[model samples]
Target: MSASSPTVPETDPVASGRPFGAVDVTWLALLGLTLLTWIVGDDAALGLGRSALLLMGLATLKAVLIAAVFMELARRGRMLLLGLGAYLVVLWLVLWLILARG
Candidate 1:
């Protein structure tokens, strides 16, 4: 409470040195997903084309979860979310096109 110390609003947890709850959960989830992915890879989940598709789907889901929760994109403006969605859609379409050609 000294005059020399800058005062911050009590509502801002970041300013108070408290960790973000969501960040911890997101990190744990990411670690679990990474382990799952490794297990899937060892089991030859990427061997067949269909299995590859499933693996890709799982990876995309993990990416989305990490982006939304860890990156705090969900709380961002609608425009940012929309852009992310569009990028994902485009990536999906490109992958589908490439797979379909083979």
Candidate 2:
């Protein structure tokens, strides 16, 4: 017997007017955020303490996005994603406090 080919839906976003899907959008966002972080790190004159905190905050955001989107944890493992996101936020806060105190 001949195998039937899988049919593509006519309403698919790629097939329609939209070029980017959720993953593509997420990737672009990550790229932009990375560029912003690089710029902030290179030219942020907000003092060492503030700069460190800002960089850490940006890093935490990137980490959460990567884990949620690229890792597919957001869809498949809500609890795990939440836990990781919470942990990242807490770590960022704790580090910022420590750096600020010093």
Candidate 3:
């Protein structure tokens, strides 16, 4: 997820020398990702397991965007990183338990 996310600037755009459109592009990307997740999750042909995996991936992507851009954690401490890692782990565990059938 972080692989696709843009690194947020540590300082204001004026100081960082980035254009104002960067924020707008991030906002649009978040919205588009959310919509895509919703659409893919609702596709019956994807079946349960595939839909779950795809949705989980999308959710992680959205989370990354929120943390890195909206929350400004690109250059922050490690707590946020730990929190996100824990969140994905828990999410995968729950999905495994629910999707795995003996």
After the best TM-score superposition of candidate 1, give how far the Cα of residue 30 lies from its true spot, in angstroms. 1.0
TM-score of each: 0.62, 0.75, 0.67
What lDDT would each prediction earn against the true structure? 0.68, 0.85, 0.74
TM-score of 2: 0.75
Q: Model 3 — which ten-residue stretch has the worst lDDT? A: 6-15
lDDT of 3 by residue, 2-102 (tens): 69885654666755876664557789998999899889977999877777777887777777777776776655645886688678758965885587442
Winning candidate number (lDDT): 2
Ranking by lDDT: 2, 3, 1
Alpha carbon lDDT of residue 34, candidate 3?
A: 87
- Screening candidate 2 with a backbone cut-off below 3 angstroms (N, C-alpha, C), the clashing residue pairs are none
- 1 or 2, which is superior by TM-score? 2
Residue-wise C-alpha lDDT for candidate 1, range 1-102, written one tens digit per residue: 688965655634566677666677778888888887777767853555555565566677777776676666765555776677677756765675677566
Maximum-TM-score candidate: 2
Per-residue accuracy of model 2 over 11-84 as CA lDDT, tens digit each: 54546667666678888999999999988989857877888789999999999988987887876688999999
Per-model clash counts, in order, read: 0, 0, 0
Worst 10 residues of 1 by lDDT: 45-54
